[model samples]
Target: MKGKDKCKALKEIRAKIAEENDIEYVVSECKHKGDCKGTCPKCEAELIYLEKELEKRRSLGKRVCVTGLAVGMAATVAGCTPASVIDPIVEFFGGGIGTEDLAGAAQPPEPVMGEVEPPIETLDGEVEYVPDSENSSEEDCSGEDCSEENGSEENGSEDPNGGSEDGKGDNDIPDLAGEALPPEEF
Candidate 1:
């Protein structure tokens, strides 16, 4: 072969080798860049799969952030509403609602001085009254007399045989005091 023709043939063979190795070089470069714009069919498939995964992750992140914001705004609005706002509406309905009606009614009743209204009693029959003059007045008795009277009333009502008024054994008193006493010797 002629020298020029031989050189041309060698150059053509090198060019073919370089063309074959180009795919490998492109892949290496793409890997170094942390992403791939794959030129070959296999690498392009991998890159498409990765892009789909990244898109799914981004959508999930957006959904979570939006949901969190919605929940936070709802909580903030709920907390901001005045506790007193419901009171007037409840009171205007004749004061027979929940705690709101009671709280509203409580303020007005407190300020009106004198002539305090008596508590409504729930007894079935007409109330009986023992007059102050008829009842024993605490002012007439000394402190000692009052104490003795109270003590006598309690002790006199108690049964002597360690039993109650209903003739049942007294469950409240322990047997320890009786156990501690020595037996009587003749």
Candidate 2:
């Protein structure tokens, strides 16, 4: 329902209640008549009066369902269209119309997932491994620090053959007494 329709419906309900209680119903013209937000003095007074009458009816043990009327009036007072108020209630009761009403304006667009291609296939039904040159820049190292030259004596080893006396030129392993564990443990 639009604002006008909601206002009309509220007026009809108010009239019906007034007629049932022997109260005279008067229709006053409002400046915002067609697009009444129910904030105007006339509409606010009518809603308050109607609420009071409903409270009286409830106090007298009369069963009155004020849910629809109250919500409609509240929505109008808050300057919201009736559809914005009613759509969620209709949806809560399993009505599918709400999604249609809320589709474009009220909802956010869905997220998109990137597509990944499979590895290259080979004739033997196995994925072929092609090493990329940009990803393979590993340098060969033989000592604790790759920055050290092969014949450097900074390690306090006087023997020039990497602390090895065997003329076969085999490098001797350094003392690991105070050294950290190898990277494989990590």
Candidate 3:
């Protein structure tokens, strides 16, 4: 339902609940903190529950409106209108929507000159048959602190686990191997 209608329905439900609780919807000093002057706690809780319900209904209505607008836009983008465009698409896809004579109804226009690039060619014996993917650019390997023109190597780091230049398990970090860790807490 629309937001206004849903809100009205919620208001009716609130009125019913208020009547059942012997609560008077007066313009008293109601701070809306589960406290109503000269009324029981049940009345205050019922009003709060009704308010939340009304808010949920309004939120749902807004979502439904937005979803409907999105569906409408999708339909337009998919060419749902203008039966001319749809019929050609169906015939082009071999659905045979129209006569067999006009098979080129949806044929795409010839691409403008130089708009499309020719595929890369590899000479049988003139050049090695290397796919474009196997080649790597310098930018692909040289990243932050890639010391040897490659990716980060945790094992070859400055830490002790990384073997030193002398081929020993030495590190530049402070030697705290003898220090004990803090005791584990529950």
TM-score to true structure, per model: 0.14, 0.28, 0.17
Q: Is candidate 1 or candidate 3 better by lDDT?
A: 3
Q: Which stretches of candidate 2 lie over 4 Å from their true place?
A: 54-186
lDDT of 2 by residue, 58-85 (tens): 3333444433433444333234447855
Q: Once superposed on the true structure, which residue ranges of model 1 sit more than 4 Å away at CA?
A: 1-38, 62-186
State the weakest 10-residue window (summed lDDT) of model 3.
61-70
lDDT by residue for model 3 over 48-127, one digit each (tens)? 44333323323222111111222321123233447755777655786522222244433222223345532222112111
lDDT for 148 (candidate 1): 33
Model 2 clashing residue pairs (backbone)? none
For residues 129-173, what per-residue lDDT tens digits would candidate 1 score against the true structure? 222342243233323443433332223232223333574432232
The lowest-lDDT stretch of 10 consecutive residues in candidate 1 is: 61-70
lDDT of 2 at 77: 29
lDDT of each: 0.30, 0.40, 0.33
Candidate 3 TM-score to native: 0.17
